[model samples]
Target: MKPIVTLTINPTIDLATAVAEVTPEHKLRCDAERRDPGGGGLNVARVIRELGGESLALYPRGGSTGELLERLLEEKRLRRWPISISGHTRENFTVTERKSGREFRFVMPGPTLTEAEWKTVLDSLSTVAADVEFIVASGSLAPGVPVDFYARVAHIAREQNAKLVLDTSGEPLRAALEEGVFFAKPNRKEFRDMMGPQVDEPAGMAAAARSFLEKGRAEILVVSMGADGAMLTTREGQYRAVPPPVKTASSVGAGDSFVGGMTFGLARGLPPHEAFRWGIASGTAALMSQGTDLCSRQDVEHLLTQVQPTRLA
Candidate 1:
């Protein structure tokens, strides 16, 4: 099988620790500190690897933190295309409480790239495109990068005849949509943010999605609604996939897992609805794990059996 290629313009070192509680004006001590390589596309790659799929992760790296991130990926034995930069990479912190089932996340801004660095990364992608089956561009754009970076990648994917799956938010997502994409995975709030005040109701959300479809901006639009499940809209039809209710352990990385699962299914030529089942199952399965561990093959397989897709009129 050809490898799935994931591009992450902004990547980070995810440091998670346990704390008794998050108290105001106090330093609380905890246990079980863990650090992992993260970022949207990287998380998707992690999920793919866990599911017995092969993927190549590409992203910019810089300084000592970047070195740490690379070492972590090396430990996982994941293939990578690292674009060297000058500034240090960023770290995101997640604090989890064992007794309370609460998690707090602190995200920081990643390194800013120079024009030369940006151009180098794009040039590297052109070379990578020739061998990749799918180009998955996910996550935020770092400073010094244009909002349309993903849009440019979409064009490159088209030129290479490779499918593109985009998972992002706000203006970058809007820009990608304007340039057209193969698929977009947006959570409920992100969809609302992109559509502005227009997506006030469920019907409005559907309408906004239909408008995007009508314009051919995206071949498929998946809106993830957490516990409410997900809504999938495509040119062929619309459908909803709901998973069997399970108590969520932590919501982190669920959406990325969903994108990974959906891309995996689509890469295998599965229909939209069937792909959606895999997506929802992967998402729910990720929610069943702690911290940023994401979904395991067994978790996804068990959840797949309990997922049901309903056609919408």
Candidate 2:
């Protein structure tokens, strides 16, 4: 088995285009379109492949859109295992306004999954995760899937002796934490919402995350603050990786890139603090690219020099 395996239950075909401007009630002509296979775990697997790491991406596929998604990932030469589903995979659209450089995104709730289909995903994980070091479950649950899906994944990872790295939000995240994961990355807002109103600042974030660690909810937690940077909290201590300022072309896929880089670094035997810096550099590098373009290996290497990680507590 590969060292890392990623799972995306709700995947999408991302269609992106650029327009001169966006105005209500006007027909806006768009530039040439670009399509990418997108979803949290898929993006993570893509970024890992871009960084010269190997990982297997596991996700559902159906209909013509799903077929195209598979083709797109194939073009990128990403290793994947597609679970067959009865529902057509969803398509998400993004239009970047060239004049204002603003992006407008239309995201569809993904296709519903049958009970048998989701159970199939779990069953597959039992086999695929048996020898993998890390099982990265990222993205949302599709309609008709339980909110405890990732929690179930965590249980499988535990039974298989694999570390579960989760990147998601809302009740699914909360439930998964109850089941416990090895690591979790939640954006600042999501972290705040999950931790409640009392965790209004970074100071409180460390304390709350440590509490989770002490309770065995997670071994490590990361709160990403976009341009501000990200904080890593573990039972041992807290560290923050801050990036040098750079102009951001697009924010799409940055978070997934971060998770990919960090997880890849860990798989490569980097210490937690150093892996946190890799995540910061990779995420910042992703911001330097235009729509749907993730960070390249060269860009990540260059930005690695610009990331400075400091012990917070």
Candidate 3:
């Protein structure tokens, strides 16, 4: 097994297409479609591979869509271990309006997981936890799973001395935070959802992150502000990064790319600030592609030169 591992309880096959205009009650014909294996941990693994790193993607799969998802992952050559479930995996659709440059996303809640199935996931992680350097568990919880699922994963990470990097929201996020994590990233929208609308400003966001850091809820609290940029707060100090200007085709997979790049840098023994710079570059690089295409190594390398991270403290 590779030293880096990612866990995704809910996975999906992302289907994307473009249409000229969206009108109510109109049968709008879309252009050719593209499908990709998606979900938080899977996307992160893909980005790590694009950056010349390897990770084992552990997720649950079921039915026809699940088979298609595996085939897509195979196409990307992602090292994966997919657990079989009774219900079919979900599919997410994205439609881009060419005229208005607007994107519409429709998501489905994934299949339910039985207690035995969820325990199997934990068992799988337990077997590999000590051997891995990081356990990245992201995405939303499916039905039939407890809210403390990630917190349970966090405990395994702590027990194995592996860093837990989380990218989730709501009660699952809060539960994991109570267990403490090495790194936790919540996009601006998710941050707002968790901390309320009052914490939307930069300073407010920073203060919120600082509170978590001071409370030992997380060693590093990163609030990812789409387009605006990202801020990182730690006990040592705080830093902010502004991504270089790039025309965006879609914001899909950008945050996952950030997690992948930052984890890749940290796994290579780089410090948090430098790792965060890599994250910004990766996220910017992701914007350089259309649809679900993640960041390429070349684009990331080039963008890394343009990333300027500032010490806020």
Candidate 4:
């Protein structure tokens, strides 16, 4: 099987710490900080690696934070190809309240990429995507990047005969769907925004997803419902997999882990329904981990046995 390729337009150095509580204008000491390479696609790639699969990650690098991101990936021994940009990479801060175990995330809009810089990313994809079986374009468009960027990525994937596994939201996601893709994963909030609030119920959401499939916009759609598990919609039918309960440490990377597991199963030639189970298992496993630790292979394997998906009428 060919290696999976993942692209993250706006990568970040994730900084996490714990404090007794969060209050305005009060100086509070924090626990030792933990830094990790973060971004939707990067997290997916990391999860794939954890599941014993191979993937090549592509992302832009800039400034000192970019350098740190590279070193972090190296420590994890993830294969990567970095493109240089003039703007500084962004850093996201996560604070966990020790008393309540609640997490507060502070996200920054990533650096603005110049036209040339953004085009360089497209050019790189065109060059390396030919032999890959799947190309995952996840995360947000950075400042100065066009909304149609993922649409363009879909075009490239189609040209290369690769399955495009896309995860994003808003205009970029809508634009990409216009170009069509092999699979898409959106959280419930993002799904509501894309398909309208009227499609909030399961039946309505299924109809909306099938409509897109009929139009050739996408072959499969999965909506991550956080602790409620996920819903998978394909042309053949619809299914829902609710994960077994686990105490959620943090919900940060659950979506990415789901994508990674499902994509990995697909690459291994598993049918869509069976692969959907892998996604549910991996996502549930993520809830069991702390910070950005993501899902462990043991946990995923254990959860896989517990997941029993039911067909939706």
Candidate 5:
């Protein structure tokens, strides 16, 4: 089987803790904290590994946190292509209030990349893109990285004859779309923001997606709508996947898991709708776990059986 390669321009160490409550001006006690290797692409890579799939995580690392991130990845026995940088990698904090079940996240902007650093990353991607069948570029671009970074990666993927699956938002996504990509997975807010005020309803959303398809910007569009389910459109048809109802632990990383599952299905040669089922399953599974634990292989398989796909006109 061809290898799966994920490119994460910005990665971090995710620290999660449970607190009774978060009240301003009041000191709060918290439970033990858990730390894990994180970032959008890293989450996807971790999910892929949990599913017994092989993936190479390509990202930059620096400072002491970067060392911890490397150690964590080593503990997972996952392969990595580390691009050493001068700046330290950032850290993200997730605080879950056990009583209210509310989760608050504090994300830090990652290390800034220099012109030389960016060129090195691009060169490395040029090499790795050749050996992989799929290149999953998911996450925010750090400062100093051009907005068209993903677009360049998309171009490289095309040159290597590999599929590029993009999971990002805002200008980066819009910029990449201008350059054209194979697939894109954006949540409701990101989609709305990209579509602007013109798209306010479901039909409008569909139309905006169709516009992208018509322009050949993306072959498949997956818009995840949180608890309302997800909308998937392809050249062949469109469908909405409604997952079984369950209590959501933490919404963080769910979207990344969805991308991971969708990529997993595509890698296995599944049809679009079938692949979407896995994507929804993976997302719902991630919701069942607290903090940054993400989705497990067992949860994903079990939830896959409960995912129902409805065709859209």
Candidate 6:
């Protein structure tokens, strides 16, 4: 197996806690807090680390918040390469309502990236792509960055014969799909946004995903439906796995964890079906933790034993 590399263009430092209630124009006393290195790719890298896999995390950062983000990742001992930028890195906040079990997430738009700065990421990928097996680009694009950033990455991945796994949305996601990635993970909403409003139903989703595969947009596509579980589609077959209901602490990192599990499995040459189950397991495990705490290896292994995958094709 070759090395795994993850790129997060708009990563954040996540601060989370529980509050009795949230009301505007009132002082809301919060409970004990937790801080973690965050953003789509960072969370995926953390999940990969928890699963006993190693990955190189690449992102741009600056200012005090950026320093804090770097410190957080350092505490986790994740291998990282941070590109210095002009503006400060952003921080996101998650507040869980103790009474209703609802989580309120306030996401900040990350700093804008200039053409020169964004190009550094591409140059870095060019250097690492040759030795890597998978290049996973997850998370939202920063302001001022081209929506085609990931498409440029897709071309680089192809040049180096590396698989690209995407977990993003909106124009960026749509553009990358046009480039034909190795795999893609789109939640129910993102899938709907791409294929149309009718794609939310399971049958419609399967058809939409199959169409994507047939059109060469993606070799394998996974649609994550919260509560309804997840489904995987490929040229060879389609499979669905439902997670056993468990008390969810926070779903902050579940999607990233799922991506981590899928990459970990595929890198180890596991069968695609089995790898899909691993993704389901990792996602369920993530729900078992609180705040910024992601899935654990132990929980993922235990959850893996209970995954019942059904082939739909």
lDDT of each: 0.88, 0.91, 0.90, 0.92, 0.89, 0.91
lDDT by residue (37-77, candidate 6, tens digit) is: 99999988888888888889999999999999999999999
- How far off is residue 81 in model 5, in Å? 0.7
1-313 in candidate 1: lDDT tens per residue? 6889999888999998888778888878878678899999999998888877889999999999999999999998899999999989999999997669789999988988998998888888888998877889999899999888888888888888888899999888988888888999999899888776676677777788898799988999999998888999998888887777887878899899999998888887799889899999998899888887888889899989998888775
* Residue pairs whose backbone atoms clash in candidate 6: none
Model 6 misplaced stretches (Cα beyond 4 Å): none
- Candidate 5: regions farther than 4 A off: 25-27
* Runs in model 1 lying further than 4 Å from the true structure: none
Superior candidate under lDDT, 4 versus 5: 4
Better of 1 and 5 by lDDT: 5
TM per candidate comes to 0.96, 0.98, 0.97, 0.98, 0.97, 0.98
Better of 2 and 3 by lDDT: 2
Query: Backbone clashes in each candidate structure, one number apiece?
Result: 0, 0, 0, 0, 0, 0
Model 1 quality (TM-score): 0.96
Tally clashes: model 5.
Answer: 0
The segments of candidate 2 whose C-alpha lies over 4 angstroms from its true place after superposition are none
1-313 per-residue lDDT for model 5 (tens digits)? 5778998999999999989889898778888888899988888888888887888999998999999999998998878999999999999999998789888999999999998998899899999888889889999999999999998998898898889999998889988888888889988899888877655688888788888688898999998998888999999888888878878778888899999998988898899899999899999999999888889899999988999899886
The lDDT ranking, best first, is: 4, 6, 2, 3, 5, 1
**Candidate 3's C-alpha lDDT?**
0.90
The TM-score of predicted model 3 comes to 0.97
